[model samples]
Target: DQQVKQNSPSLSVQEGRISILNCDYTNSMFDYFLWYKKYPAEGPTFLISISSIKDKNEDGRFTVFLNKSAKHLSLHIVPSQPGDSAVYFCAALARGYTGNQFYFGTGTSLTVIP
Candidate 1:
């Protein structure tokens, strides 16, 4: 079962436009949500994170929103740039004493057309 799912395998947008990526989870026990960006052959880098206690978090060009009732979350990037083209992975921290173990979605590749 896919506890975390990024429905869109890929997304394309024009530069300077807004890009929205969606994710869904089936595990209600997950308490921490994170978004990571990765380029080919490199490890993912943390982009933003939201704790279950909070509904939203933002950093510069990126913002993440969580809706606990729907078990859904989304990442929004404003003024999408060519540099933002990469795979975005939505991850959740497993419940119990797992020491911050993360379950990742397959990932969504974003392409910005300049």
Candidate 2:
């Protein structure tokens, strides 16, 4: 079974509105969470991340919240822009996994409209 999962396959939002993406994980040992964005014909780029110790982490327009008890996390993009439209992926890794292994969710396609 997949350790990480993104329930939503696609979502749309106004350019200036907020875009919310969600993910769930089954492993409690995952101590790090990351959100990545990918565009066509390009590799994924890291958007933001949070450690298990933190309940929330935020960047300029992106924020990630983790609920350890529920094994869920969500990413919020405020003041969304056209450039923010891309496929978003949720990934998790254990605190000290040596193989550099990451459990990744399928991905959520986000469309930001003007």
Candidate 3:
């Protein structure tokens, strides 16, 4: 099932500006905790994240906020740069019948214009 979705497939932002990415999940049971960034021909890397118990988490220029009531989450990048251009994925940890499972959004491709 497609529990998570990124409505915007792509986003373009000017360098030194702010970039925001949004994601929504259908399953309320999902315990969202991570955002990932993927570059060309590389593995996805952990970005910023918010635990289910907390509404927001920040790391360097990245921040992730969660709205559990609305099943929505977002990632914010300040002063976006060309190197920041990549595919971003929002993921959640779902405690399934068997064990802990991860659900990921389709991903949103970001373009930062220098």
Q: Point out where model 3 deviates above 4 Å.
A: none
- Candidate 1 local lDDT, residue 105: 98
State residue 96's C-alpha deviation in candidate 1, in Å: 2.0
Candidate 3, residue 108: Cα displacement in angstroms equals 0.4
CA displacement after TM-score superposition, residue 83 of candidate 1 (Å): 0.1
Tens-place lDDT per residue, model 1, 1-114, is 889999999999999999999999999999999999999999999999999999999999999999999999999999999999999999999866647678999999999999
- Model 1 RMSD, rounded to 1 decimal: 0.9
Clashes of each: 0, 0, 0
lDDT, residue 101, candidate 1: 74
Candidate 1: deviation at residue 94, Å?
1.6
Candidate lDDT scores, in order, read 0.96, 0.96, 0.92
Clashing pairs in 3: none
Task: List ranges where model 2 is wrong by over 4 Å.
Answer: 95-97
Q: Is candidate 1 or candidate 3 better by TM-score?
A: 1
Q: What TM-score does model 1 achieve against the real structure? A: 0.96
Provide TM-scores for the models: 0.96, 0.96, 0.95
